[model samples]
Target: MSEFIVFDLEFTSWPGSLEQDWSAPGQLREIVQIGALRLNDDCSVVEEYEALVRPLANPRLSPYFTDLTGITQEDVDQRGRAPAEALGDFLGFCRGLPVLSYGNDMVVLGENVGWARARGDEVKNGFLSATFLNIRPWLNFIVPETADANVGRLWEVLNLPKPAAGREHSALFDCYSFTAALKHLHAMGHWLPTGFL
Candidate 1:
C-alpha cells in the first residue's frame, strides 16, 4: 500500500525584535523539532518518527520559544542532534514516501536544505525530489465555509475533535490534528488527489 508521511516542524524563535531573521543565512530559524506520522493507504497509522534538532548558530532557546512550544533549553541541549544529522535521519525514515504537511513546511525545508548545503553536508537529492502536498488549501476547498480559516481556526472549521488536553502546537500533535482532519474529509467522500491515495 502507498504511504503518506504526515509531518510537522517546530523551529527556534526569539520573543521580540531580536528573533532570527528569515533572510539571514546565519540567523534563519533552525528547525528544533520534527514530528511525523506514516499512514497506510487507508489512513491507518503505520509508524511514527520524532526528532529534536539542535540549533547550530543559535543554540539557546528563548523564554518565549519555551512558552510557545514547551520545549525547554535543557530538552534540546540534552536530546537534540545537529540539524544536518537530524534531517538525514528523518529523510531515511521517510523512505521516499509522499509528504503531507500544513502551512509552509516545504518552504522551511527548502531553507533547511540550503542551510545544510552551505555547511557541506551531503543531503540526498531524492529528499528534495519527494512530492509535497499542503493540505490547507485542499481543506479550504473541501470546506468552503472555512475558506478564510487559518491554522488557529482550522479545528473548528473542519469539525475535528479536539486533541488530547494540552496537545497542540508541538509537531506531533499538529500532525495528529491535521491527519484527523484529512480522515474526516476522506470519510465525507471528498476527492483527495490521487497522489494522496
Candidate 2:
C-alpha cells in the first residue's frame, strides 16, 4: 500500500506571539513537539512518529504555551531531545514520502533547522530536501465554511464523530483530527488531493 505522511507541530509561543507573528525578541516558533502519521491509501495508519524537541532560543516554556499545548517544562527537561536530533529523526521518518500538513508548517520546521545550524548545532537530516503539501486549500474547497478550522478543530467543525481518543493541541492528537476530516471528505466522494496519494 502506498503511504504518505500527515504531520503537525507544537511550538513555543507567548500570550501575544501569534498576533505579533512571533516577532518579539527571543520569540521564535521553535518546535516543542512533532506529531506525524504515515497512512496507506485506505487512510489506515501505517506508522506513527512523535518527537519532543527542547527549544533552544526560548528554552523556557511560557504559561500560555503550556496551557495551549499541555506540555510541561518538566516534559521537555525529561524527554525532549535537542531540536537538531528531533528534527533529524522526523526527517528520517519521512524518508522522502509525500508529506501533508494542515498549513505551511514546513516553514516552521525549516526555520527551526536553520536556527539550529546558525547556533552551530549539528543537523544531519534531509530537511533542506523535505517538503510539505498544505492540505488547507483542498479541505476548504470541500467545505468552504471550514477554512478557518485548524487541524485541532477539523473534527468538531465538520460535525463528525471524533475518530480517536485524545485532546486537541498536542501534535499527535491534532494529526488524528486531520485524518478524521480527510476520511469524512473521502466518504463523501472527494478525492485525496492530486499528487499527494
Candidate 3:
C-alpha cells in the first residue's frame, strides 16, 4: 500500500536563526519540534510521530517567535536539543517514507542540512537536497491562486473537519491539519499525480 508521511516542523524562529549564519552553508536551524502522520493508501491515518528537540544555537527565544508559535522559552529551554542529533533522530524514524510539508517549509529543511554540516554532521552524504514532498506547490498547481494565496492558510480556507483549532504553531497540530487538507482534497476528487516530488 502506498503511504504518505505528512509532517510539520516548528522551527527556532520565523525568519530562523540559520538565515544569518551563512557561514554554515549546508546547515539548517534546529527543529524545536517535528510531528508527522503516516497515511495509508486509503488516506487513513496509520501512524504518527512527534518530538521536541533541544535548541543548540540561540540562548534566548525571540518574543515574536513565541507569540507566533506559542512555544515558550521555558518549553524550549526544557526540551530543545542539537540540530544534527534531532535531524538524525527524525530521519531515522522517517526511514524511507516520503515527506510532505507545507509550502516553502522544505527550505527550512534545506537550512537544516546546512546547519548539520556546519555542526560537523554527515548530511552531505545523506539524502539529496530536493528530497521532500511540498504540498503547497501541488496545491497551487491544482487549486486556483485566488482560493488561498498562503499555503499555511490552506487549513483555514479548506476547513477540514476534526482538527480542533488553536494548535496552529504546534508541529503535531500542523501535521494533523495537513493530513485533513489532503483527505479533504481527495474526497473532493482532486488527484495527486504519481512521481511528484
Highest-scoring model, TM-score: 2
For candidate 1, list the clashing residue pairs, or say none: none
> Whose lDDT is greatest here?
2
TM-scores, each model vs. reference = 0.85, 0.95, 0.79
The list of candidate 2 runs beyond 4 A from truth reads: 128-130
Give candidate 1's whole-model lDDT: 0.75
For candidate 1, what's the RMSD?
2.9
**Ordering by lDDT:** 2, 1, 3
User: Global lDDT of each model?
Assistant: 0.75, 0.88, 0.67
Q: State the displacement of the C-alpha of residue 40, model 1, in Å, after optimal TM-score superposition.
A: 1.3
- TM-score, model 2 to reference: 0.95
* Per-residue lDDT of candidate 1, residues 76-194 (tens digit): 98999877788878877776788887677877777787888799987765465467878767777768876665443456667778743445668887777777777777788875676
Better of 2 and 3 by TM-score: 2
Model 2 C-alpha lDDT per residue in residues 1-197, reported as the tens digit of each score: 68889999999999989889999888889999999999887778889899899997789899999999999999999999989889888998887688899998999988988888888888876754555788798889879978888788999999988867878899999999998888888788996777656
Specify the poorest-scoring 10-residue window by lDDT in model 3: 123-132
